[model samples]
Target: MSVWDGIVGQEPTVNLLKSVVASPGSGRDDIAQSWLICGPPGSGRSNLARAFAAALISPDQGLSDQPTRVTSQVLAGSHPDVTILSTNKVTIGIDQVRDLIVTSEQMPTTAPWRVIIIEDVDRMLERTTNVLLKEIEEPAPHTIWLLCAPSAQDVLPTIRSRTRVVNLAVPSNTAVADFLIRQEGVDRATALKAARLAQGHIGVARLYATDRQVLADRDELVIGLLGLRRSSDAIILAGRMVDDAKSQAARAVEGQVARAESEFRQVNGLGTDERIPPALRGAYHALGGKDEVRRRTTRLTRDVLDRYLNILASVYRDVCVLQNQADETAGLVNLENRPAITDLSVRLTRRAAIDRLETIATARRRLAGNGSPLLVFEALFCRLLVSDR
Candidate 1:
């Protein structure tokens, strides 16, 4: 498959990347050594990186004499020729960078070049970035580094200056819907609805479209937030939310683990690999990757939960605005929840609603840090109730 096929709704980026790969020796050829791909969470940044890597390493076609070979590999784990470094523990420690440095200094094995991909590059701690800066500043001629992060500002200034950036924007809703229908085989109606609900996040759209449980869970969570009025109610809701987040995280990761194991078995014969000791080692590594992914998923779920809570907070803020006869658009959630919106507008003043919004924002920030979720919810509920007085 061609590289352009993998990246959806990024024609300009596709053309630029294609030109760079086609002309490896052109005067404007300084684009390949290091690239910082920046975008929102579901904006296809990683997909672009993978496609670019595939194109760079794919075999040359229709060349006469001995064609110039493209020697490269996509390394997610330990490889003699390539290294992909990410956080092995809770944090992206300096030790990981040290290992990356040692690996980068080594020679290529089966290819003319070695490549390194560091996902979640923004997670690199300051100390770790300090260690990585030297290597990034001066890399091996035959080596390439690709880093992916949410935004260029999240990365250190030094790192950003040393690398060319490829910015990928969130695809339009139509593009997202088309991709879901064409690539994912989702029905057009469902795809369109999910695309709208996801607000341009491809990953979120896929989850919303494919997973009924996810949609139900989010709906329940929002409903619970709206119904909560007392401190006890809030506490119970927080507990349920934590449990739901854990379960969803577990189920998602278990599926990934199963897929990885199945792939492992397919690649190496069942009994043959069973007899080889190194085969078990590879299996363990695969499992480890699954566990890491599960942990990340859990963290991500918690973040999503927090955002929902923020949305609920905004709804109350709107009610407060409506009560004070301020601009009606100031705080409405759906605008379509008109009856409830009108009722709330008549009940609370703008000052009261603004106070509630502040409380919600504070709770969200606190929830992101290390605090008891139940206790935080209790405080928030009490404050909101008191404000209603």
Candidate 2:
């Protein structure tokens, strides 16, 4: 019934946050003005931070009212008093951090506090974080900073020491299924299947439930591994995967680029398809509006590749579960691919399955380290080739 309702399987954290908002600045040194929310992917860390920011901005009526328009603005990241740096770029540049520091110094215009949220503080390079540590340590009385990362260890010790850490667990399968059903109006069967396939990732579960094509694509990718008997076949499959991931990334970027362009046009009172005059073209470049499209494309491609690799890893996870004779209801991730799971389990021993998992993990690391996708995936698939006789 509260704004925290959007957050799943985080009751203790929710209660702690509620208590904080209810009793702020009562000489409780434990209640921190700076927070670092750490969690696995798809655990809703960003959303939870937004809810907390909404409450901070309007503590008196925020939690109780389930977020009025002002708080909704906070969630949408459009509130005047709330500054969110949710970058899709690989690295959080120094300029963005400097801007946030300036914003943090500003007094709340219409809310109780000026809340600054950095979605992936771990993405910042060392020099950029050094530019922020001092400001984060001594913030204005009305300022609050909320930072998010995959885990506390991902951040530097100095940065970690200056903030209160909140760790979130991966949501349970039943919890994710229920969330999908409630949020997406999906039937129990669909919800359960997506929940299992997503391995308790709420956002991924929602995508699996609503998008038949997404489900089919993942299933096909897993099934394709069975047909890669030759090295050439593996290379071909890797190319297809790279192409698909890029296409998905491009589709994702198109909408965002369109929105940015639309805003650019609206700001200058130009028609949708109208050409910008030569003078105004420089203004667009000055705003970095011209480069945004390339940035969006680059960012989303990296993200899509990461996700595709995770999906590939999950296939081996399923095979491992089957080989071990684990609890079917709870342990299996790809329920719809049970046939493929069973087949892979029969083809590969437990050791072989685990080896493939390690291969996938290595591939992920290499990709993160800026390895070429076609090469990485080809190498991964060759290692993952069904060789257990």
Model 1 worst lDDT run, 10 consecutive residues: 61-70
The lDDT per prediction is: 0.69, 0.82
What candidate 2 gets wrong by more than 4 Å, as runs, is 24-30, 59-61, 258-290
Per-residue lDDT tens digits for candidate 1, residues 1-389, read 34455466788888888777767542224445878989887788877776666555545411213323332234133335556665534458777778887877877776555667788899888888989887787887777788999999989999999998988877877899998997789899888877765656788788889999887776676566556667777777777777776677777767877677666666666543465357477755756485677676767566566745644665775576566566543434334454655655555667767877888889887876757666776677667653244
Candidate 2 clashing pairs, residues 3+ apart or interchain: none
The clash numbers for all candidates, in the given order, read: 0, 0
Clash count, predicted structure 1: 0
Instruction: Write model 2 residue lDDT over 1-389, tens digit each, in one string.
Output: 56787898888898888888877442235358889999999999999999998877664446664458877788777899988898876789999999899889988898867889999999999999999999879887778899999999999999999999999989987888888888999999999888877876778788789988777777778778766688888998999888877877677667665676678899789998799989888766554454776777766777767877788788888787777777455476666667867887898888888888888889989988889999999999899888647
